[model samples]
Target: MPASTEQAVRVAVLADSDTRWKWGALTARRLVAAEPTGFVLRGRATPTARQLAETGVSTTPPREVTGAEFLREVRDAALRGEGYDVVVLALVGGTVRAVLQGLSELALERRPVIVTGYVGVVYEKLADGLLLRHGADVVLANSRHDAERFRAVYEGVGADASAVVEAALPFLGGAPYTPEAGRDTLVFAAQPSVPATRAERVYLLRRLIGHARQHPGREVLLKLRSKPGEHTTHLEELPYQRLVRDLAAPPNFRLVYGHMGEVLDRTDLLVTVSSTAALEALHRRVPTAVLTDLGVREVLGNHHFVGSGLLTSFERLDAGVRPEPDAEWLDRQGVAAGGDAYASAFDAARERVADLLAGPALPPVSPYYTADTAPGYLPGILARHRLDVDAPEARPGGLRRLVREAARGAYRHGVQRVAPAIRRLGEL
Candidate 1:
């Protein structure tokens, strides 16, 4: 396809440490910029600043900025006017509040801001979506249920969701559903995610192992959210090594990580304790089971899925009963961002943005922002990141990245051969 030379809609996403949120923003960017040169992209913030670098996904590093600087820069720039076509902010919480704070005093009416928020997981309207529906030009919701909720709370009316766009989540593989040649692989998407304790993590692992043992022919893949040890606010209380030693691990079962799109290509069955990843699998038409043996609402958060007709226990697994997904549950969950649904949703959002930019002049949100309507002070967006008014420096990618890649490969090889020996010595 030829690159578009039209008036490019420069989309800038206020990125932070959250990878999932970053992907959500990226999805919006990609969707809005259907044309090639119609997009100028930048991701601001550390932690996940270079999220897409060196991966199969994208090579461009998000322009880095401090959380503080991001808020200030976005505010000052928006005040000056005409730097970006649209600025994407976190939908649930993040820069939206601070950006709104900056815009509160200014009487700018034509400023374009889009909030990208996902809806697969359940969350309350604690901060009223950080006033996204009210302030932002549009709020992107991944599900119809979420779109309705975003509308109901912000506009204070149940008439319909207010200025909400029901677009298919972009990060989801968006691939067609094709049954595997044979059912040989079962993936357990592990997300001990903040709420789970050390003991609960071990229990989930044990369940996975027991299931793996039951089906000797199948290779059970334990797909982790993060690597064995990595820094994240959403901590998994326990390390896999400490728990693996106690169990009789099956030879076929092992830890694996890669592009989820590629992993799902080979997976026959997926098991999880409430994960957006499981929803991704179900969207792909893969046979998925939500484990509910522990009955710990805080840990797995799989309660909502119980009525989906996809929940199963060890007893049921042992009895050879496979649960099928109920259509109502699947529809409500917003499964499959592919086919005609995705195309229609994407087109709708694009049309809305086009209309907003090209239509009549709009009035400013407010000249004096009220505290009662406001959420709270922005933490990570302002104080942490060393944001500046200027654009982030362009990263050197050609020779430099190649050299770094070579060195990293050799270091990784050395660690793979020596890590086990080091682990054994540490055990003593």
Candidate 2:
């Protein structure tokens, strides 16, 4: 592309320091390198920021911006006669939903083209087919199986039901190893919330403890990712901690917290209750077993990649089998599919953004000026600020209520100490 055309095609990504952001940053770098004039707008707090900055990529200051702020920034840039060729909202779940709702209200005129990558599971109400149906110009799935699943569910919900499965960031390579006898080491990656899954994780950990005792020299490592200070109490609160504590007393069992990449690399076999880490392990050609407890087989099942050395089990893993992933297995796991598919998905998103920009400008949908247009937006913001004021619940049902209360407590306890600025913003 010519310099003028390249300069006109700026791309901005809204993401943080997560796996998805790492992939998005890689893709952005590739795109900008292809078109030298292309610029990347990235959040300072994003995990990939330092990596990008090392490569001489310009970055914006870390802001406590939400999905609403993301959209507003894009719009503001356009209003100031500065428009991007594409604005990619690489957020998952509630954030994505908020962005869509905000866009719906804006009635944007000459809006910069918008695109989004659906990187998380669509099983939850906040991150399900509803958001997929209304949020993006094009919905991109991490796997073909996921794409088909999304279409089936969305079709039932009267959604457009069109989506492309693209290999998620950190593209996989062909599997190189065959199953070989190795030391007995098991690794488990923890997920964010959803107590049911956490319970399952506890159960799996207990089972692994038993296995370690039986196998003598075998080892079990539980990888934990909890906020500081909260980690000790949270672990102490688990019903299985007694088992874990006993196991920790022995030389065979260990608890490893933090340093995810290093832990994964050292593990012999990986086990997960329900986490995207299983996919990450797959990339490393590690044999992975996913526990199917909590009656969540349909949602957390690993049956789709059975032939790929990725096993789903409700029971303990058998000791004799040496699991190894092959090239054919990687292909089945969507590793054979090239990165171009992901790029194509981005292209489709670009088309949708063009359509939006070709139309008229829109007005703001959210009246409260908080992050989301949803009912609990104000309260959620206030709770984060530790304002000591009661706000309406963000989600429906008792479970959401409990989660909000917990979040509020987290905010009040220590989040306020880390950043008193949110309180100032809330006051304003």
Candidate 3:
């Protein structure tokens, strides 16, 4: 809690996507007794109205703003001497770096306790992501395995690792799994950019449809991350929705979207290539499998599950092979099987936060990559987000807002329309 007696602790969660928003908001609540105000970073993967509504996490609606606009808001708040007690940066590495730089520029008298972390399993850009997130008061690691890895990455580079705190995925909560009598629902959680290709996506979809064909009595769902023209954390260049249009699918199988936890409620079996949904399902003791039909490759991210005992092929699933999750692996990964452990996952984080809040004002946010350290690198990151040492101009409005929207619309058009057409032509 904050030093203020009149108001509760104020926490601001800034996120780039719907999934990140869920993680950020939930993590904010878990870390302290606070109701987080949400800010959606306007970008390609900006959460849609439907996606935001589906999360059902934040009580207040999120304010959508570009990177510059967000920085202005923070700077203004700091100038007013009314900054949030905590600000959770639920964004990508580059954006995190940019925000850190922007904050350092503010040099406020009372800076918020900055917190940042990964949304899920970090199969890619381990060093890049961890280092970019370095200057926060808390760099949360979602598992013991991640905590160790994060420390190693920082210590390897001689950077301070004190900020890396172990915590579980904040979104991991639901009713424990129980056997459903008839029409068991099998959901194949889909990622936007994993196995990033039309053929690979189609093959996975066909495999899912094949399973549905084999188990006619069972209900199968392709739990999509985003609908058409809507992006998630990753860009869906070749969506399953576009490919499924040509495929002849069975009535038992269909595409579904919305909250993953709700879907897992009736899920008899949950399958994925390497989605974080696997962790969510495992937390609830839901039958989960990391698909091996695509091969246990790092590119597909299933390599992260090698020792989890959850990796199996669609063939095995078709043959009724339900994997018993490795208990040790689950503990190491911080996916609690309910009870006291799961409840206490954020205890360390909470304590760390309390200590920070009670202590003297925090030093300026000093990211690892600075102009002094990485003159060639740091500028590019900040420039990408239009951030600088000086206070930003007023928030985007009138002509500026329209111009930004037009540019964003053009970029989205290139992604959702022009680029896919080019890919299809190239294939031909």
lDDT winner = 3
Candidate 2 collision pairs: 17-47, 106-362, 106-363, 107-361, 107-362, 108-360, 108-361, 108-362, 109-360, 109-361
lDDT on C-alpha atoms for all candidate structures: 0.57, 0.48, 0.86
Count of backbone clashes, every candidate in sequence? 10, 10, 0
By how many angstroms RMSD does model 2 differ from the true structure?
9.9
Which runs of model 3 end up more than 4 angstroms from their true locations? 1-7, 388-402, 406-428
lDDT of 2 at 414: 53
The best-first sequence of candidates by lDDT reads 3, 1, 2
Question: For model 1, how does the per-residue alpha-carbon lDDT over 1-428 read when each residue is reduced to its tens digit?
Answer: 11123766656665443454445455655556631111112231123222234124344544544343444454565567634555665433544544555444344455554545553565434234434335566667777766666666655632234467777666665465576555688887776462357777777778778878888888899876444333222444565655677788889888876556677788888877787777778888888888877773644578757568888876786567778998877776677534566546567677777776666554454311245433253344433332332323212344643564467545644443355468667877
Among all windows of 10 consecutive residues in model 3, the one with the lowest summed lDDT is 388-397
Question: Candidate 2: which stretches are off by over 4 Å?
Answer: 1-4, 15-62, 120-135, 152-184, 194-201, 228-249, 257-261, 292-296, 299-309, 312-318, 322-333, 336-428
What TM-score against the true fold does each predicted structure earn?
0.75, 0.62, 0.93
User: For model 3, what is the C-alpha lDDT against the true structure?
Assistant: 0.86
Better of 1 and 3 by lDDT: 3
Instruction: Estimate, for each residue in 55-132, the C-alpha lDDT of model 2 and write its tens digit.
Output: 233344233333444555656665776655554555544454555555555555554444555444444442353443
Q: Write the per-residue lDDT of candidate 3 for residues 1-428, one digit (tens) a residue.
A: 23443556778899999989989999999987878888998887887788888988965779988776777788787677677888999999999988887777777777889999999999989999998999998999999999999999999998999999999899988888899777488999999989897888889988999999999999999999887777888877888877987789999999999899899998989999999999999988889999888788989899999899998888899999899899999999998644598889899999998888877888888677877788988888887888643432334455766776789879877875687678667756
Better of 1 and 2 by lDDT: 1
> Total backbone clashes of model 3?
0
